[model samples]
Structures are given as C-alpha cells and as structure tokens.
Target: MKHIFKNGIIGLACLFSFNAMAENYTIGTGSQSGTYYPLGGILAKIWSENIEDFDMRAEVTAASVENTIKVSSNKQLAGIAMGNVVLQAHEGIKPFPRKMDVSVLFALYPNVVQFIVPADSDIKSIKDLKGKRISLGAPGSGTRVSATNILASLGITDKDIDAQSLNYTATTNAISAGQIDAGVIVGSVGVGAITELAFTHKIRILSFTADELKKVSEDNASYQSIEVPAESYKNVSAFNAPAVWNILIVNKNMDTDLAYQMTKVAFENMSKINQVISVTKFTTLENMNKLNGIDLHPGSLKYLKEQM
Candidate 1:
C-alpha cells in the first residue's frame, strides 16, 4: 500500500510539470472587422489544435503600426504586419512612433494597392485621381500610408485630391453610393471587402503606368510592382498595379524555443489553416525564405533550416 501511494504521487508530479511547461502565446492581429483579424484567429486555432505544449491565441489591434508597437513593447508575443510597415518599423520611419525591437517570423503575402472607381466615373488612369474625391483607406492603416506615399511619389499631394480616411467597408460603400470618386484598398487580392464590393457594384481597377511605377519605387523602396490579373475582381479587366509585401513578426525578446515552435506549427499546419481563411493561401515555404532586411528570430531560422 505504501509503495502504491508513493508511485501515484510521483506520477501526479510529472503530470503537473508537463502541464506547467506548456507555452501560451498571443498573436497581435489587425482590426476586428478586417482580414488580418480572421486570418490571425484561424492561425491561432491551427497552432493551438496541432502543436503540442504550446497554446496560441489572437488579439485584435489597430493594424500594422499598432501591431508593431505592441510587439516592440512586449505586449504581444507575435504579430501580423504589412511587410512595408515591418521594414519601416525596423528602420524607425514614418508610421512607427519610434525605433522598435521587432523581428520577422516570415513573409505572409502581398498587400496589393487596389484603386476602385465607380463604373460611371470618368477617372481612367492613376493621374485622373487629381482633384477627385477618394478614400485613402483608414487612418493608422497600412493602406493609408501606402496610398499617401504612392501619390506623393507621383507629385500628387493631399492638396491635389479630396482624400478621405475610411476603412475598406466604408470606402466600398462610399464608392457605391457615389460619395467618393475612387477608393484605395491595400489588402490581399480577393479580400472579402473587395469581393463584396464587386458583387454589388460595377467597378474598374486603375492601372499604374511605367513612369508612375518608377516614381513610386524610387520614393518608397518597399513598394513592389505587381500585376493584379484581370478577373481577380468583378467587372474588372487585367492590369498591373504596385503593391507592398506583408509579414508576420514577433517581439524581439520572445522565447527562442517557443517562437520556433510557433513558426514551425504555422508552416506545418498551413493547409489546415487555409481551409479556415483563404487569405492564408499566400502563406508558403518559398515566400518565407524571401524575407530580407528584417532580422529573423534565431528560433525561426532554426525551424526553417530544419525544414530545408
């Protein structure tokens, strides 16, 4: 009887230790109503369900700039950010309040700059936006920053256009109602907001000329020239547009092993993740390796190396 009791106590102790070792991590995602939130939620669910000894969850925040601040302040273990913002945050540029101690886990997708005009609008090219009413996305959003920079590069100032700060939904609705002449959306291609807008309204996506692309690239090195194929949206023909990269980042001080496990679980269970959110379709192994400039956490490197 004494031996049995001792063995039972020892087993209980081991079980308690194992449970205590479980790591709980939170990912800082974007606005509750935006694509980043749902995508991050799905990723958290996948990691929590599939990864052993690690529990993951998502927290909604302002967006890219806010996520970077949260990650830098150690308030969040990880975050999803626009790649352009990630680059700026590391260098302590415009959007970031100050220099940040953030590192990259992986590149997620391309945040395409989509310019939408009402079907009846006379606006035909990027330059047509001059003196026109347009929604430059919401304040504190990466979309607004990209829009401002792109327009600035083309020598189009805020004074040249009637710019409104609004979210994707509001911008879409405004355009449909003719409250705005054009809307600038910086999100993944086939995003829910854009999809819904296309279904309800006849819209045209504006294309960037070579000269315009050159100015945008020269002004903001983070901007990439991307060809958003025709039929990607409703009532739209094919055209090339400029876009910025998006990345998943984490606090520089996060536990190396835990970060490694999280990164590993994300990539490993990506298929399951995509089933929950189509935006995650962009998450892939090849793009994960293309992340440059942003310092990758050592643990992330370890996991990627193992996969290789």
Candidate 2:
C-alpha cells in the first residue's frame, strides 16, 4: 500500500512538472472573419504540436498595423502583418509613433489590395470613386493605410471622398447594404469577407490601370504588381492589382533558440500547413527573402543558413 501511494505521488509530481514547464506564446492576427485569424491559428497549432512544452495562441487584432504595434510593444510574441505596414513601422513612418523594433520570420503570401463595388455601379475605375462614399477598412488596419496611400497617389484625398472606416466584414456588409459605394480590402485573393459578399451581391473588383499601378508602386516600394485571376471571385474579371507580401514578424529581442526552433518547425511542416491553408503554399524558404527589407530574426536566419 505504501509503495502504491509513493508511485502515485511520483506520477502526480511528474505531471505537475510538465504543466509547469509549459510556455505559452501568442501571435497577433486580424479579425476572426479574415484570413490572418485562421492562418495564425494553424501556425500556432503547428508550432505547439511540434515543440514540446510550447503553447502558442492566436489573438484577434485589427490586422497588420495593430499586429506590428503589438508585436513591437511585446504585447504579442509575434504577428502577421503586411510588408508595407511592417516597413512603415520599422521606419517610423506615419501612423506609427516611432520606429518599432521588429524582425521578420518569413513572408507568407501576397495580399492583393482590392477595391470592390456592385457590378452594375457606375464606378468603373478608381477615379470614379471620387466624391463617393468608400470604406477604407477598419481603423488601425493595414487596409486603411494601403487605401489611403493608393488614393493619395491618384491625387484623391480624404477631401475627395467620403471615407468610412470599417473592417473586412463590416466593409462588405456596408457595401452590400448600399451604405458605401466602394470598399477596400487588403487580404488573400479569395478573402472570406469578399467571397461571402459575392454570393448575395453581384460585385466587381476594379483593376488598377497601368499608370495607376505604377504610381502606387512608385509611391511605396513595398507594393508589388500582381494579377488577380478571373476565377478568384464570382463574375469578377481578371484584374491588375497592387499586392504586398504578408509576413510573419517577431520582436528582435526574442530568444534566439526559441525563434530558431519555431522557424525550423514551421518550414519543416510547410506541407502540413499548406494542406490546411492554401496561402501558406507561399511560405517556402525561397519566399523568405521576400520580406521587403524587414530584417530577419537571428533564429530564422540561423535556420535558413542551415538549409543552404
């Protein structure tokens, strides 16, 4: 009986020790309805499963800008953000109060800047959006920054349009309800909000003209030219759009070993992650260099060197 009691106590102690050793981390993501949330969840799960005693959770945030802010402040261990947004933060550009200390883990995929309106609407081009009500995306979101910059590039300022700050879902809802003439969303090609909005309302994604694309890209080096396929959305034609890479970011001060382990595990399980999130198909070693000037975390750098 004494032996049995001693063994049971030993088992309990072991369990307690395991629990005590577990470390929890969080990755900031966008709205629950957006791509970042699910993608972040999948990544957190992957890292947690592969790294014993590690628990990573995805926290809902206002998307890129907020993610960068949180990650820099150490409110989040890491975050998913657009390349431009991270660049802005790193450089202490507008919206960011000061230079944020963050480093890139890797580039995930290109998030297209989409401008949507009803198919039959007279707003044929971005120029037509002048004097019209438009949603620039949620406050503090990278979508807003992209929209604002694009508009500024075209000489369309806040004075030129009635701007509304709404999130991905809200922007779609507002447009569907006729509350806004057009809405801007920066996300994966077939973002859930835009996809769901298409089922109930015939919509068109406005393509950027060559000159306009050049202007936007020139205005922001982080912006890239990408073509959205016709089949990406219902009844929407293939469109030329400005895109920015979506990157995984961490604080520069993150433990070197922890960052290395996380980066290594993520790359090793790319196939598994891609199976769950198609956009992650871009999360390859080759794409890691597409961080658009953001410094790579030392841990991730170490892992990448090993791959070479």
Candidate 3:
C-alpha cells in the first residue's frame, strides 16, 4: 500500500517491488542544520561519485517519521528513520494511519532525546514542565513524536504547558530570546545546533528522573537508556535520556543489484561518511546487523550475508 508523501512525487508502484529504468533519486533527510541532512549529504556525494548511472542528492526534511512515510510511498528511493518509527510504519501503528510497504537498507545511528533549557531555568525534571513555556518540535517531525510520547509517559501533556510547535532552529532561538522555557530536541549526541547554541548562551540538558524513566521504558520499549557524557556540548554536563536507533530505509522495489552495490559502497566509504555523521564512527557491521525494527530488504540482506 502507498504511504503519505510530503511535497514529493509518489512513484506508481505501491503494492509490490518493481524496478525502474531511471536511476535518479533523492534522499529525504532532516533539517538542514541537523544531523540527518549532513549524513545524507555525505552519502549522496559518495553514491554519486562511486555508482555509475547514479544521479542522487539529498533534501532537507522533517526527519524520521516523515522520511519513512515518503520512502514507503516511493517518493524517495531511500531515506533514514528512527528504529521505532520504522516499526510503526511497517505495522501501521500509531503515528501512522496505514501499514507502509518498506524495508530497511541498514541501521545507522542513534538520536538521543535532549531536553534543553537556559542555565538559570528552574525547570529540572520532566514533572517541572507543568505550567511552563516549551517548544515540542515542528508539528510533523520525529522529534515532536518522540518528545510527546516521552512526556506523556511521565503524566505530562500539552495542556500542562504553554506549548508551541517549532523546529530545532526556531526552538533554540526561542530559548535564547527568553521566549520559551525549554525545548526538546532528539539528535546526535553532539548535534550541531546544540553545539552552536552553547557557544553563545549558557544552557542545560535535562535528565529524566528514575521514576519518569521507568515509566518511559515500560511504555515505549523502543527507547533505550543512554547517558550523554559531560561537556558533549559547550558547558552541557552529563545527563541521562532515552535514545532510538536510526535506520536507513528504502522502497522494497529498489533494484536488487542497486541495493547490494549501495550497501557495499556505504561500508567502503565509512571514513568520509564518518566526518559528517560522527555517530557512525562508533557503529560497526556487527552491531548494525543486530538492528531489529523493520524487515531488511532482500537485496540489502544478501549483501550483509556475503559480508558475514
């Protein structure tokens, strides 16, 4: 079945995998200033350079959930998404209205949930969000989806706060302008936006309380406990949070040989990719193979098996 497409052309193939004669493609990545965009930019550059007949580029998007939607609709040949979101899309669960016919290309990185605030903001725990001004995330973005669920698990809701839906850049700017008390950003451990924010203003990354965390993990098994080390960004201290795996996804209809070659190229160009996607530096084929949110495309699985 075809899935939703956000401002892109949806391919005609929806019910089954099919090959296309054309080789041009676009990767739907996250915000221009976020981790996914840079990662996609590097990957697009690599694929364009290495694969003959490959005409590829990356576009800034709302990220994860939206990417999954677009890829499922064949609006994109491939995209990146959070593990939980891939599962949700494939299963036709909440945050998705219908099952998406999609497959995983490979697992990539993790996006940790970071609740940011000014250094002097009194809000410390998830509970403190009540009666506060907060920027959840852009209305349709993955950051908002995760942030909303995480807060709901701790008995907090939009009604409890002066909520505004804004993207990372706007949210961070709001915090700096003293317009919002806090903002929730799910990104790489040391996302560029956070790094830049810290360079000028004093900020704090909040940690969930034990009880809040217990509730969160119990409710959403997809979220794994993680600790962001001290000083990951300027003056941002160590803090605990939940993280979700990021996966590369593609339409199951992708040319099998093309998928295999693309998978191989990704591994071969890991070093260059690492410069833009720092989290990949810590991942490996072994750990990447351990991923379990969505079904792997047969083409991708075939390549992975050969490597094993």
Q: Which prediction has the highest TM-score against the true structure?
A: 2
Error of 3 at 34 (Å): 0.5
Model 3 RMSD, rounded to 1 decimal = 4.7
TM-score of each: 0.88, 0.93, 0.91
| Predicted structure 2: lDDT | 0.87
Extract clashing residue pairs from model 1: 83-246, 230-238
Count of clashing pairs, candidate 3: 0
Give candidate 3 regions above 4 Å deviation: 1-22
Per residue, candidate 3 scores C-alpha lDDT tens digits across 183-235 of 98998898988889999999999997777777888988888888889999988
The global C-alpha lDDT for each of the candidates, from Candidate 1 onward, is 0.79, 0.87, 0.82
Which stretches of model 1 miss by more than 4 angstroms?
Answer: 1-25, 52-54
lDDT of 3: 0.82
Q: What is candidate 1's CA lDDT for residue 60?
A: 72
